[model samples]
Target: MKELYLLLLCMVTTSLGKNKSVDLELDYETASRLAGLPLHCAHVEYPNKLSQVLENQTELLAPSELHPIFYGCFDWHSSVHGHWLLAKVANLFPDTELHQNVRTLFAQQFTEDKVATELAYFNRKWGKSFERTYGWAWLLKLQEELELFKDEKFQEYAQILKPLADYIADLYIDFLPRLSYPVRVGEHTNTAFGLVFALDYARLDGNEKLIEVIRNVSLTFYTPDYDCPLRYEPSGYDFLSPCLQEAEVMSKILDDDLEYSVWLQKFLPQLFAENFVLEPGKVADRTDGKLVHLDGLNFSRAWALYTITKKLDDKDMVERLNAIGDEHIRTSIDNVVGSDYAGSHWLASFLFHALETRNS
Candidate 1:
């Protein structure tokens, strides 16, 4: 009877794994349709037939494009989108070798030299490095990569892997002590990304010492009154503009503090009405409002809110967000279709967390 039960359990486990893999593939395909990117032309074969092709043929398409440090669109956009797609796909296919490809992308992007080249200026002036919002998002992929595969086979190359994440996390930790005032803040996305990375690292390493640091940083921007500054941080990092969406997303994910989420919900309609502009042609970032500076911060938030509401089983919130995202996508198909800003690829990451999250 014991042997029979063991065999049945093994079969059940195998079947469930297979089911998850299939669901992930379907989700990827659906996400591609929702994103409407042109992957077939790029010739970047996707993991599943339904998945959108995500490749930047910029080097092939334009070899003369010299990378002017952080200014090159190809290097900046491709690196971010590529990693986003890879990480989400890996989350979907966790037990399979598909995750290996995700690791490869991270290894290529987060190398010691790349980190130095990208963040050297910030390191010198701030006495620490500044990871762009996109860079912070990339760290999410790397963290997922390490979590999905932490066994002996993966430990061999741990040196190259751990330092990059450790450096970023430690840098943020060091910055905590340096805050001159209790209200020190920066771009919404950067601040949110920093909190998410810090929280995830704290959870992964069982390092509870950093929880206060996370709490303090979060409190600097916590908006229960809605009269606070709603723009992005650093004052000058306004390529896409900052908004409340990224901070909300990070707050939802990192702290699970319902009070913060409630605070966010209270200010949602006013900010959206004032700052968000959804036309049938252009992308939806931030526009007019009290927070006039964050134009590119909406899509990331829209997608994130969509995911979180569903996870929280708040159908009303999901309905509201889906309407918002659908409206934006309808209006700004051109800007969102082929981009990571749409948050299509990170579906797998959210799903992974939904599957893996514990009440603790």
Candidate 2:
């Protein structure tokens, strides 16, 4: 595998200042570093955050006991997407050491017993809405990536993981309609961000129910939207870009390029301007868990804006998008590879997702 790595992708170097530049590419070294964060923490259960509801003293269980598969990486959602990050990286670079390690980890973790325990936790009284759409989306994303990878063992893992996936899908189907308005926050509850991945998984899984619910929810919440407050974006402690997340989700559901472009222009007219300038969010500190969200904000904004660029015929706007996208990546990627657990526990998944969306 190390020998084969010599043929791996080259790095993309971007200038940070007069003489300083950074490697923010999707090459092997960067990918390996990103994948390493999750591989190390996915099963390390200490220093975990449990956002659970306790029915009684009997429910005072450890995170590993509560979620057999997703009990690490700081929190349940981060753990779920950490698995997703590994599956995605392993999918891209199969026959590698990273892929083998991921295979081994999944074999140990993605068993019927583990998934059943996880599902039971979800089905518990007062636990139905636990992790809600965020963790659900990541779990679906993990299954989605597993199904896309080439290995037969990944399919087996996906099958073992399917019951939980189906449960989350049903949660979406049940919850979307009853909600009168979308959760437009920039954090875990952001409806648009959750729907984007869930919709992708739904379409891939051919779950028409999930797909239909997502489409209806999108149109219901966003079709009438206009003049999104992108300039007021990244409210402190924010990760997902509220404005761009909505636009990106709409880009997928619209009927045609013309239709989507029109809707986008109406919704976010600044993108149509001659010199549309948007800078990445600045993180003043990496040690603070909430403050570090700005780093993820930069990456997520890039991911959403990159998807919007695909449907654009405007060459200048697309170039602006690509430039800002790279800028966002370069701004926040260092922290993803840093030692601080505040950002390291989850930011790699955001970086990988942003890079994947940018490259795709």
- TM-score against native, each model: 0.53, 0.93
Stretches off by above 4 angstroms in model 2 are 1-24
C-alpha RMSD by candidate, in order: 12.5, 3.8
Error of 2 at 82 (Å): 0.4
By summed lDDT, which 10 consecutive residues of candidate 2 come out lowest? 9-18
Q: How accurate is candidate 2 locally (lDDT)?
A: 0.85
Could you give candidate 1's per-residue lDDT for residues 26-121 as a string of tens digits?
343333332122221112322212111223443232211221222222233333344444444555555644455444434544454545544433
| Backbone-clash count (model 1) | 9
Report the alpha-carbon TM-score of model 1 versus the true structure: 0.53
**Best lDDT among the predictions, by candidate number:** 2
Candidate 2, residue 232: how far the Cα is off, in Å: 1.0
Model 1, position 79: C-alpha lDDT score: 35
lDDT of 2 by residue, 237-349 (tens): 99999999999999999969899999998999998887888888888888999999999998898888889999988898898887888888777765666448998899989
